[model samples]
Target: MISKNVNSLIKVSILSSLSIFSAPLFATEKTIPELVDAVNGTLDTESREAGKKVKLRNHAKGFCTSGVFKPSAKINNALAIPLFNQAEIGVIARFSLGGTNPHASDKGAGRFMSLKIDGNNESLNFVTTNSQVFFASDIDDFFTFQTKVKQGAEGKQWLIDNKPDAKAFFEHIDQMLPSSSFANSAYFGVNSFLFNTYDNQITAGRWIFEPVEEKSTLSQVQLAHLTDDFLKEELLTRIKAKPAMWNVYIKFAEEGDSIDDPTILWPESRQHLLVGEVIINGSRDDEAATLQCEKSIFNPVQLPKGIAPSADPILNARAPAYIESFIRRL
Candidate 1:
């Protein structure tokens, strides 16, 4: 019989390779303000019953951690330049649950991980999720998806009207199982980015953060008994025991791959580069740290030299929404 750990590994691998969920639906053209408003509207509608808390429009609830990013041994690739060329820079990271509910259960369907690398001139920020694929393709589809989700009965009708998008959304949700600890899970950047070398060589790719330790999932019994703040508590305990680490890799897209659409996953055979490692030294669970993390914006669009976002419309729309969220919270 297969061992329990082996069974768990198999389950995770299968979930990672699950088929792409949604196709890119026709999106109506929208300005940045319009898109940001739609996103805030969804968050406001969802949080109506939760009472008055400064709800984060997305990745609303999180715990902060202090760490350092050590670059790879040699800088053979373009992407490695930013982290490796400089001294080991301090990093502030936030691990969060997906959605607007600060009191969301630890067993909720989605999780988020974001990191900001502190630098002298400009900082680099990367935001990733537990799943490799996103539910929508562009700003338009994102607005539609969020609007439908907030509409209740009307949302159900909208999903029925947009059958493929609905199917994809649920399929994506099916794979986002709760993990036993934040350090035990892998995170992915669903959107593609353009990596430019000093020599002007350009390549398209996505980011993946693989935990050094094997991932472990909570049993159904454990999940059912978890506290509302279980994820944060678990991370605190784990850090005290040992530093959590993740190897950073970028999967490069080949000619035919869809760089602009995040809903599609690149093939497993795609080439990947090990650019660096992220080591979490301690948890930033104090009230001051929590406030700093919550108030600071972590937008994927905030890139340093040598790295830029792809033409994915959804990618382009992220900054404005983040800016709007930041201002309103302050």
Candidate 2:
């Protein structure tokens, strides 16, 4: 559970970045209640009594958070092959749903994948979702979304009750490749960067990962029986069967781009670059030492070299809170 003091700092830091928040619809305290119970009206999950009691498992790569190790892990330099630079890098990739249940799968829930690339002298992190954009840009909207709805409720009813511009965002993903199918879709870092590249202080981009096997888009019904550990099993299957590979690519955005607005899209076809790859050999899948690599902590803040978080507000928020929440379990 990273730390309360650090989390408080994160919340305060998010508050200071108000100009970057895009929720004009719920800008006032009268419209959207201030001091929301993120416990979702149980009004006590934020308190130490229940909060401290929550159980979390730590990973070698990341700490405990929300009671699970999650799709969390800290990658090391030995695992990464640099694209732009000559040095090897490490990366953090996190995946999870927003629901309260630790057992919930990617079944019907909203899933997010955040990547923290540790390169020479800096870090580059890409926080993404199954949908194109995010539920909110700044921390306020994020807290509001967390407080307003109970996860895994009636999806439509929940949408109507709390009208997030999330619909518009999903519509973008649907329209972009309506028939193409991201069933095996790769992701991009839609925000701009302020990396360690002095020659180019501003780097706006996207990151993509291509799976070795061809599979259809997994459905909720199928996922219900599978669970989040599905990825673990799927990878294990590959190890028992053969090798599996995923290419990690980054697409840089143009200068002055709005990494702050989670809603806006960086024109991918116009400005983006493919950065690198992560190839997983079958060798480590069954080994205990292999699993040990997962226990190391990985945060965007844990930059090693020429990569740094962009000016994107979400990037800023994730930097501290992610590592803090992680330390709880690690």
Candidate 3:
């Protein structure tokens, strides 16, 4: 989405930072700042394309809701995090479409569920998406893909031609139908994390919020009749009548499973445990809360304790990128 003018500006900005990317090409040793720059550049390009005020780099169109997280009995044995040990935790969540344009049509766009579990001393966040696997596995690959996308159709075609995984991911996204409500769709966490038990046994796992409600999808006729901003309205009306819920499941990683590469999915046969449940009761009324949800970056790396991030380069690179994106809007 970069115009020639923005493209030239970015080239000038990154000229001095070439070495930062060069040294990390193979090792996936991308620094936080470098990743931040890459993310901000993409956001700038996207904002210019949208012809709108600066907003989130992605998932810009979303709504915030207040809720409570009830820990399942299984959670105590699964992870050693004290936050989860609590009976209930105050939670704030945002459901959004996957795009830089805040006012774009929601149809066919990817969805995101970002949740923050507020605890006494520390807070945990899960920035989940409606996909089992991501497009890129490492920082270098993600950066390259972002760069390619900025080049427009030809650059995306390069990915389809050369990168099989990226090709498959794009195909998956293309086939995804629009859900009638956010409450009906499942949300998957792309990155894997280590669940350290109090007994000192560590297990690698990823999480998914499986909807407690029946799944619903929009028919072609219905989709044709609805407006672009129907989702927020539907969700707001739905929540007023009844809360939406999801059962949290931790998919345990088996031996030989790819722990670091988020682009790879673990076998369906892998054991999964129901560790908790999320109940979004109502939309936030406070303007400050709304603004915070809209503006603040939900950094997944911000952990409480007992849980640790895997060696996934893409996972580690997210925080810095999100921080940069957050800073640019302010």
* Runs in model 3 lying further than 4 Å from the true structure: 1-56, 287-291
**Which 10-residue window in model 3 sums to the lowest lDDT?**
47-56
Q: Candidate 2: what lDDT? A: 0.44
Candidate 2: stretches off by over 4 Å: 1-42, 45-48, 56-98, 109-127, 151-164, 169-185, 196-201, 212-215, 219-229, 282-297, 327-330
CA lDDT, candidate 1, residue 312: 88
Clashing pairs in 1: 21-168
Question: Which regions of candidate 1 deviate over 4 angstroms?
Answer: 1-27, 42-56, 77-83, 153-157, 160-163, 283-291
Residue 2 lDDT in model 2?
A: 43
lDDT of each: 0.73, 0.44, 0.78
| Worst 10 contiguous positions by lDDT, candidate 2 | 63-72
Measured over all alpha carbons after superposition, the RMSD of each candidate to the real structure, in angstroms, is 12.1, 8.7, 6.3
Residue 249, candidate 3: how far off, in angstroms?
Answer: 0.7
Candidate 2 lDDT, tens digit per residue, 54-116? 533222112111100111122222223233443344443444444446665334434444554
Give the candidate number with the greatest lDDT: 3
Question: Higher lDDT: candidate 2 or 3?
Answer: 3
Cα miss at 162, model 3 (Å)?
1.0
Task: Give candidate 3's error at residue 101 in angstroms.
Answer: 0.8
The residue-by-residue lDDT of candidate 1 on 1-330, one tens digit each, is: 446686466545533432221222235566554455555553454453232245436666787887878877654455435545775767888998877666778786577889987776777788898887677876667777767776777785777578565667677777666788888889999888998755668999999999998988776787778776888877877888898899999899999999998888899899988878989876444535444675577879888777889998777667655664544443
- Per-candidate TM-scores read 0.82, 0.61, 0.85
